[model samples]
Target: MNAAAIDTSTPRLRDFPYRLRDNVRFGDLDPNQHVNNAVYATYFETGRVTLMKDPQYGLMLPGFAWIMVRLDMHFRAELRWPGQIELGLGVARFGRTSVTCDQVVFSEGRCIASAQAVMVLIDEETRKPAPLTAELISALQPWLRRGVKGTRPDLA
Candidate 1:
C-alpha cells in the first residue's frame, strides 16, 4: 500500500526472476526535470512480462494466457532523466487461478519504487479464470519467501 513501507533493507530479494532496464530519455522528464510518475508503470510492465515469459515459470501454458487483473505502484524516490533502473521481480503469491508479484525498481542499489501486481490465469478460448497446473506451481515455489510457504499452496 505505502511504497515507503517496503523493507528496502532486504528488498524482498529473490534472484529477481526477471530484470528490465530502461534509460531515462529527455522525453521522460517533466518540466521539473524528474521522471514523470506515469512512466514508472511502463517499467513495471516490462518486469511483469519478463516474469511471465521466463523459462523458469511461464504463466501461460499450452492453452492459457495469464492476464493482469490489478496493480499498485508506490514510488518512494524520484528518478531523473538519463538514469537507468533495474526492475526486480519475484512471486509473492500463487493461487489456484491467480498470482501476485512484488516488483521493485532500483538504481545504484537504491530502491526508487516498488509495485505489486495480481494476474488471473485465463483459458485462451474461454477467457475465464483457469486453474494453474501442478508443474507450473512447483516451478514457482522456490521464489516464495519461507514464511509465506503453504499460504497459497492451493495452486499446487
Candidate 2:
C-alpha cells in the first residue's frame, strides 16, 4: 500500500499480543537526522525474538531452528532519535512448517512502521524444513490474529 493509504493515526499495538520497547540511539540516525530505515528491521527482529523465546509462547523448539524467509515493511513516518519505539507483534498466519508474523512500530503513540515476516521451522540436523509440532501449534493459537485461519491467511 502507498504511504497515503496507511492509517498512521491508529495505534495498532493493541492488535498485537507481544510488545518490545526500545529507544532510538544517536548511532541509529542518519545524516538526515532521522532513524535510519534499516534500523526499523532490527527493531522488528527484537520483537520477533522476544516472542519466540517466551516460555509462554513455546515458539522455539529443541533441535529445531527458525529462519526468516520473507519480510515486508512499510514506513509511514520518519522516526527521530532520542525517542522510544514500541514494537508489537502477533501471528498473522500459520502453516505446516512456517508462521507469518505481523508487526508494527509505534513512537509517541503513532504508528511509524508496519511489517510482516514469514519464518520457517527447520531441522538442525538436516537443515531442512520441518513440520510444526502439535504442542507448538497449540501454544501459538492464542496469539493468532482474529479472523486469520491457519495454513496461510491472505495477507493482502
Q: Once superposed on the true structure, which residue ranges of model 2 sit more than 4 Å away at CA?
A: 1-11, 146-156
Error of 2 at 31 (Å): 0.8
- Estimate, for each residue in 55-116, the C-alpha lDDT of model 2 and write its tens digit: 66677889999999988888889988789989898888877788888889999898999988
Tens digits of per-residue lDDT for model 1, 1-156 = 664454545464344555677677788788889988888888888887876787656555888887888888888888987878788877778777888888888887778888888888889899888887777787777655434656444535
Cα deviation at 70, candidate 2, in Å, is 0.4
lDDT of each: 0.76, 0.83
Compare the candidates by lDDT and give the number of the best one: 2
TM-score for each of the candidates? 0.80, 0.86
